[model samples]
Target: MTALLDLVLDAHGGLRRWQDARTVHAEGSIGGHLWSLRGQEGILATTDATVDVQQQRLVFGDFTGPGLRGLFTPDRVAVERPDGEVVAERNAPRAAFAGQGPDTPWDRLHALYFAGYALWNYLTAPYLLTRPGVVVEELEPWREADEDWRRLHVTFPETLATHSTEQVFYYDTAGLLRRHDYAPDVLGGTPAAHFSEHHVRASGLVFPTHRFVVPVQEDGRAASEPVLITIDLTDISVT
Candidate 1:
């Protein structure tokens, strides 16, 4: 294992705990201008997400409307009623976003796919660095937040569903992920800077409760305005 990877995994509650985990549950609300821009406002205003620990699957409870459910996997996104009546579903959902720009409005399936894959990756990082088929290299240190943060340039294989094939993660001295940079393909490769903060532990794992995404500036820094997405998590549990 790489030295930095070891530090990161251990800091985030360790690989052993993660290996023993089957699923993670968190209650949170996601909001920002991006929602309104994509025409998916209020879908996740007050919802709970259940992530399958070892698979790229996430289900949002009461996600689309009153007493509805949203299921997201790498290959499919569906909205169903509480009794399992399918309201809407799409196959190969990523293909539906082809040739789209940041301003292009997304349908409900598009929003579900994006939210599912994005959070699945975010909630399982560093350990993701340890997964098979992932390439991880320690890059030159980055100076941010008045400290020098270590950088990891990660390349995900086709098997992983994520924001992009390649991403850069910045970790503080304590090995907590502070910032992540990527160009989201669904947004026509919009360069974005995602920040995670206020980490707390649940079921022997660590996670950030307050997270936000902003535009990446020309100088490789985060812009101060126009928050694209904000997520506030609470009551996180894993088993």
Candidate 2:
């Protein structure tokens, strides 16, 4: 394991603990005008979500609207109703976005794929770095707010369905992740900076309850104002 990843995993919760805990449950609200822009408003709003950490599967329900349950695996995404009837299913969900851009009109399946994989990736971080095919390297320290923050440049293999293959993670002296940067390949590779804060611990695991994803300028820096997406997670538990 890389020294940086070691520190991060230890800070959040030891790798052994995370490995033993097979799943996590989170009930919360997920909203942002970014969804509206993509024609997927309310798809992920006010939901109860569960993630199978090792299997990389996510199942969520109790959306803002009725008859919407989301199921996502690495290779497929499915939307079902309360009656257990699937409304949409897509194989190789990531490929469904081929030649798509931010302005592309989104369908239910598209929305499911985007939200499902995105949340799965977020809820399983640092620990996910320990998975096979992930490459991690220490970068020069980044100074922000008069503090020297350690940085890790990570490259995810194709097997993982993240926004992009390459991402940068920022950590505080205590080894908790403070920020992450990547371009959403499904969204035409738009650059974004995600900030994590308001950390709360549950069942030996630490999580940031508040997350913000903002647009980045051509120089690959965050925009001056306006967060594009905001995710607030409450009632989080790991077991």
Candidate 3:
């Protein structure tokens, strides 16, 4: 493993421990005006999400409204009701954006793909960097607000369902991830700065319980306006 990757994985919890924990469960509230804009308000708000860590799959739901259930994986996504009736589904969800730009019309399935892979990537963290086909390189330390942060430039394979193939991760001196920057292709190439805080340990693994994503300026600085997304996770477990 690269030195940077080694330090990050060890800080979050050893790679071996993460490998053994095949699943993670988290109860949380996810909210943002973006959801309402997409007509999926409250879809993931007040949710109980279970993630299959090894397989990169997620099943989430029990929302307040219609009690929607969702299943998401790299290949496809499906939403069902409490009665196990499939409501919406999309196969090869990534390909759905072929030749499409940021203005592509989004449906419920697209939202599923966006949320599914994004959360999976977030929850799996440094361990995800260890996967095959992920390329990581150390970058010069970033100095911000009088603190120095180690940085990594990562390139994900096309098969991986992340915001974009290229992303940058920033870690504090203690080796915990503090910020991530990416341009989400699905969102019309919107640049975002994602910050993680309020870390807590569960089952030997560390997780950031609070997360925020906001728009980034042309110069790669965070905007001063409202956040695009906010997620607060509690009651977390891994096994």
Candidate 4:
């Protein structure tokens, strides 16, 4: 399991090399329109964010307006409204931000990314390598990677029910994640989908600078027609 974890890390640019680094930084634009929750008018929005990894903190300023800010730390999360009023706040366990156990694998790593990418930049494959009980099931080739590449799929254990959905990660020859896919578990439940691309290396690590996610429609049809939200990360720092 440890060796397997090492392979995963090496695929993402080596855990040791990433850990020894003091910080990582990134800059980019995030812009997309949201399908109105009520199916009314689409809301177009954009944001500019900076992630400071050493302190495990993030600062985001919405580009669409003034004073929209969000800050995240190891122990707490806070978001500020456009008017500068704190709109929401929460406390979380410190370990939640830390990496997983030695027995963890790619499936758990995918889960971590799915569950936490909305809140933190603490994801790096090494954390998943240590988590226990996560099952990694190899999937047969399902799709072509591109005009010149091939793709592989892997699954995680079901945490919800027998019909509960499992995380699916798509990787290329170099073992970097090129895409992620998952379906809904409950009948009539909205299917969840997430896709990431535009990978680039900065500060000793490979990272996806742009990503988009949407929930499948209630009718079990296609996911949300218009993207609900798109995140653009910039000024990312790992320390």
In terms of TM-score, the best-performing candidate is 1
Q: What is the C-alpha lDDT profile of model 3 across 144-230, one tens digit per residue?
A: 668899999999998788898899999998889999999988777778989999998999999999999988888777885668888
TM-score of 4: 0.55
Best by lDDT: 1
Off by over 4 Å in 2: 63-67
lDDT-wise, the better of 1 and 3 is 1
lDDT of 1 at 220: 95
What tens-digit string does per-residue lDDT give for candidate 4 at 70-137? 55554555566876677665565233324543223322222222222333332443333333444555
lDDT of the candidates, in the order given: 0.89, 0.85, 0.85, 0.46
Worst 10 residues of 1 by lDDT: 122-131
What candidate 4 gets wrong by more than 4 Å, as runs, is 2-6, 21-25, 31-69, 73-76, 80-135, 145-165, 183-189, 214-225, 233-235
Error of 3 at 105 (Å): 6.5
Better of 2 and 4 by lDDT: 2
Instruction: Quote the positional error of residue 19 for candidate 1 in Å.
Output: 0.6
Candidate 3 runs further than 4 Å off? 63-67, 81-84, 97-106
